[model samples]
Target: MNIINRAASILLLLVFFLAFFQNSVHGRPLLLSMSRPKPDDAALFARWLVSQSSWGVLNTIASDMGGAPFGNVVSFSDGLPDKGHGIPYFYLTTLDPTARNALKDQRSSFTISEYAIGTCGKKDPENPSCAKITLVGKLKVVTEDPKETTFAQTALFTKHPEMEGWPKSHDFQIYKLEIEEIFMINWFGGPKPLTVDQYLQAKMDSHTVIA
Candidate 1:
């Protein structure tokens, strides 16, 4: 009987470990430990994609490039793992063209692809089923208020630890996308018409289950 009990205990431990491994991706815990939200729920789905992503393409008008649109790959975070504000924050230096462009013209947009989160399975990134979002609005530096700047820096540094060690001479500052419009495509239909308010107000409750 003792032998049988010992075997059962070992089996239980194995099961628990398996469950933990399944919930984690790349050996890191997922934000909120939740799966992809249903595509029908545009607001929640958009928020989930933003929260899970660590990087995206930030677009700005390039005056030096003849007033053309320029896109740069950048790292960003919405907030800490559990508390996502759905507002993308970035750390940039004026030495980089992205920051310089933003200063010249605040008109900008940030795009995130669900493929980066690794939930799309074998689907191509451009596939309709694979979700993507573009936040269209102004990209402004967050420096006027000390409190807001501190909060933005914290939100950025927590997700991107390497930022803390960047050279100070580069003068890296905080910038955020003030989302005026949200365009998301997660399914066969056209892009979902999600307003900035709807995207910002979406809640990630217990019912927002994984795919």
Candidate 2:
């Protein structure tokens, strides 16, 4: 073959090999990959924890709370949707004692976990897959204001439709949690858990990037 033709042929082969290698490393077909969990799952789990039980061990500061951290099951509802983000919102009744204490302190953490058993029906505390996610975030009490209350209630009802008929007799107070961090472990075992920023950014970029 002519020199120019030979060089062109080699260049094409190099390009082809490079493309193949890249795809092999990172490309995954939709059918073969795991789909992301829907936002609803997080929302549902958060609401379920609150509605079914007001009891959750609260993680709090020691010196602030009489020099030893405290864990207590407190009744709570989902707060407000995160600013510019649609997240599970929760509300704490103003009349609740725990809510009052949290309001006074203004710093706390809350956790919600699912129940699962090992193959032998034994409770495995070390199971990563069964490990519950505990959200550590800054908390603030939402005092009564008709507009804020309306917005929060609307979001809560939308997420938890079953609570629609519940009597409005309770004086619902709003509490907004700014999620600073989240801890989750993979019980199935794989890579490390993703940071909230990393997870959200990946979702955003994946949707925007061209194939």
Candidate 3:
């Protein structure tokens, strides 16, 4: 009887370990884990994308690729968890082409999809109603000031904890999109006419933007 009990205990432990390994997301917990707002709430929808997403396609004018527009997948953050301020920030290194291109030409746009957030069930990525935002503006490197770096790092590490362990030789630096234009589509009929001010200042809990 003791032998059988020991075997059962070992089996249970193995099951638990297997389950834990399957669920672990790079040894860090996900943040801003929340459901999406209604499609009518444009502000909330935009905020939901910026705050909840861990990465997006950062568009820049490629110098090596015959000056064509280049889009690279990159991780980003605005603020801590749900406290996002609506300005997307990134951690990049010169070793990558996106950072080099941005330095030469600040004109850029960053795009995120609602489908990535899993709110657009059964909808194709090209569907306008599925929701996507392209923030157009200048990509400027953030000042290396200690205070600013700390704030950005805290915001980034909260969501992408694995980033903290990147090799130091790569010289990762903080960059931000100085948004000047907003283009978002969250519902049918047409694209939403949302401005930069309306997007940034839109209260998270308020639904002022009509579909």
Candidate 4:
């Protein structure tokens, strides 16, 4: 190869290594924020975590398990990536205990972790700095409004392409968390004091850039 082409090839390889170091100590996003919000900015931090996560543990008031807070890992979405509305939506069915429990009692909460996105550095998953949130509210099935179903289907299929091909026999239905409270810890001290109003209304227009 010519000397100029050889020089360009080396430069590209160096650039690639730098990018690997920068993104994963590290993280990447598309309907996601590039960085964590200041811990004190409770509202922003809560919103950032929720918008970036595609799934979390959903808790419900169990009936068969004797009313315990039964937690189940499930997939979810708030909106389309960074364009979220700060409300989490889900795809579930009666085949799962979570959905069945929700029908008997709507009281529920959903929890997500920043560590799942690889932005927690080397921190342990349970470490406070890794960032975790529990959104408390009601989990209800969507019995009406076809439009909401359409929006949810698009959101789910986009993030989890595999769901599109899942067996039709499973009969998955749409569900949502009507958030009434918020609990989050992105750093030290303790869970930041944030309320549902502050969380849902926090502006994210500045963080709307997508991949």
Candidate 5:
């Protein structure tokens, strides 16, 4: 019995470690071995964080809940793999409170952490060096412009293939955050003072492996 128990314990530990490292190894599409940017490159770091991550907590003002802030786990994409454009695009439906809330009030914010991308190994999510970003902006639907809608659809579908098969009756539409302010923490001191223009303008190095 003691031998069996020890073997079981060892198996569990092996599974845990594999699960932890697998994200870095296979979670991303093309980025199999991309190293994170230095803490000082605020814009590149922020863009990298957004591009590498596939989902995040999107916060909106819930009108039905007495104007309270509500955060929902949502899937989003900036672009395909290493081609991210820095603006997060989402596929949402009114059946969900998040889309309903956005329709009533466009004010919103989206937050993503480096921990999700698997680079912040062994560090608590809240640890100062773990790196996190919150994009403050107005969430708006993108059906008005045919060009933008096409881009959104391609970007979202490429990253999240399952979305293509999502129930159409739910009326999922493309929505994007028009980032106005950027707040990021990659190192210790405090939130990195990043501007929307800076973030959008920041260019990823061709050599940088991001996917």
Candidate 6:
């Protein structure tokens, strides 16, 4: 009878261990799951992309009168937030073709890439240290909205004081970008993305999970 009792106890212990192992393998811990960003990391990347002025590229898709799309590059200033959306705001003159095109058609996309100072040393194409972040979103041109125009103007002045004459030099207009999606590339040969949310939150929350 004692032997049978011992056997039953061992069977229950085995089942408990198997269940524990399965849960451990498949279940994400509450803390670990919460650490990941809730949604796309656009807000975080936008913040960093705005930090370095010359490190980013603004990609715009515009169309001619025939509706054929063309691309152009324009310097931009980061703008004030519209609640949660990462709306990158900037100013441009109506004389500028890109700005003119944007005024005509507010639907556009902008890409911001990480800039690397080219080195003379042997280059490694596969494993570069730099990371690139591109944000695809809609653009709007505003000429009459005083609040938005003022915000864009202030941001431009703060970033480029030399451009203080922008308001006076031409038919200055403000453009606001409403971010829809973001893409990021980390060329450091890691399986997981070098998450922008992780990067931004790291500045505030030093605790990070190590894989």
Cα RMSD, each candidate: 3.4, 15.5, 5.7, 3.2, 6.0, 17.7
Q: lDDT tens digits, residues 98-186, model 4?
A: 99999889999999988887678899999988899999999998769898888877887877777888888999888999998888988
Candidate 2, residue 87: CA error in Å?
Answer: 3.8
- Counted clashes in each candidate structure: 0, 11, 0, 4, 0, 0
Q: For model 4, which pairs clash? A: 23-26, 23-27, 31-81, 31-82
* TM-score quality measure for candidate 4: 0.85
Error of 2 at 99 (Å): 1.5
Question: What does candidate 2's lDDT look like per residue over 148-200, in tens digits?
Answer: 66666676665445456655687655565556776554345532444556433
Quote each prediction's TM-score.
Answer: 0.84, 0.49, 0.81, 0.85, 0.85, 0.55
What's model 6's lDDT at 9?
Answer: 100
Instruction: Name the weakest run of 10 consecutive residues (lDDT summed) in model 1.
Output: 25-34
- List the global CA lDDT of all models: 0.87, 0.48, 0.84, 0.83, 0.88, 0.52
What TM-score does candidate 1 get on C-alpha atoms? 0.84
lDDT of 6: 0.52
Report the Cα lDDT for candidate 4.
0.83
- Global local distance difference test of model 2: 0.48
lDDT of 3 by residue, 46-137 (tens): 88788878789999999899999999999999988777889898999999999999999999999998767666779998897788999999
Evaluate residue 139 in candidate 4 and report its C-alpha lDDT on the 0 to 100 scale.
95
On residues 1-211, what C-alpha lDDT tens digit does candidate 1 reach at each position? 9999999999999999888886674754454456777899899889889988888999999999999999999999888764678999999999999999999899999999888777889999999999999999999988788977877788888988889999999998899999898889999979998999989889866444554
